[model samples]
Target: MSLVNRRRRPPAINIVPLVDVLTVLLFFFLVTMQFKQVSVLNITVPKIETAGKNEIKEQILIAVSAEGEFFYNDRPVDKEQLEGLVQLAGDTTPDMPVLLIADEDAPLKHVTLVMDLCRSHRLNKLRLQSR
Candidate 1:
């Protein structure tokens, strides 16, 4: 009987499929990611006894200074302009949440005025921010 010798092939791993899956995951995360813009206002929010976490995604930020000034998204806005902005937001997205961040020393009148504006515009999802 003649003995035959066979050559053994080295073990190999297929990486093409792994690379495709990684590429798909990267694209998925990049497409569905949400970016938040940081607020530049120096607001000293008041402390609260019980404050729940705010999980609303789309929100309009209104800042009230201690001196009774109003700011929308960090930009100064007068009473009428603030009302117009609230109205526009209500007309566009009625259910959109409004976040009021007032300074600890801010007057109650300013806060009430913003609340009134929101109520008049029918934007009922109002969240007051506190420390």
Candidate 2:
């Protein structure tokens, strides 16, 4: 028999060990994973992937357009209407965060007005939603 033609062991790989290790890692991650409750109010924001990321409790969102229009939770409201809404939210949850999302072309006075309104309600946990 030729030296190179003798019995040669076929190359093989054992995948059982790899599968076992992967399963163990999956279980470890699952055990350590934390699931959070997303609030219904979260759906109102547009393309806001990271807004109020660290805020666990439901927050109040105040949006200002470039035309100095005020929107509370996506509903167009006047200053007095916004005040009532803010007061209601603030009274219900004292520690709720207020997220301010303003257009780039929006006037500074509109932003200031919303900020002032939030402060009046004693909703001090404020966050400016920005990219």
Candidate 1 lDDT over residue span 3-29, tens digit each: 456666899999999999999999999
Candidate number of the best lDDT: 1
Q: Could you tell me the lDDT of residue 71 within candidate 2?
A: 82
TM-scores of the candidates are 0.69, 0.58
Error of 1 at 60 (Å): 0.7
- Per residue, candidate 2 scores C-alpha lDDT tens digits across 17-130 of 999999999999999999864333322333465654555457777888878888887778998999999999888887888888787777889889889889888899888766
Q: Candidate 2: minimum summed lDDT over ten consecutive residues — where?
A: 37-46
User: Highest TM-score, which number?
Assistant: 1
RMSD to native for every prediction? 6.6, 8.5
TM-score, predicted candidate 2 vs. hidden true structure: 0.58
Candidate 1 residue pairs in backbone clash:
none
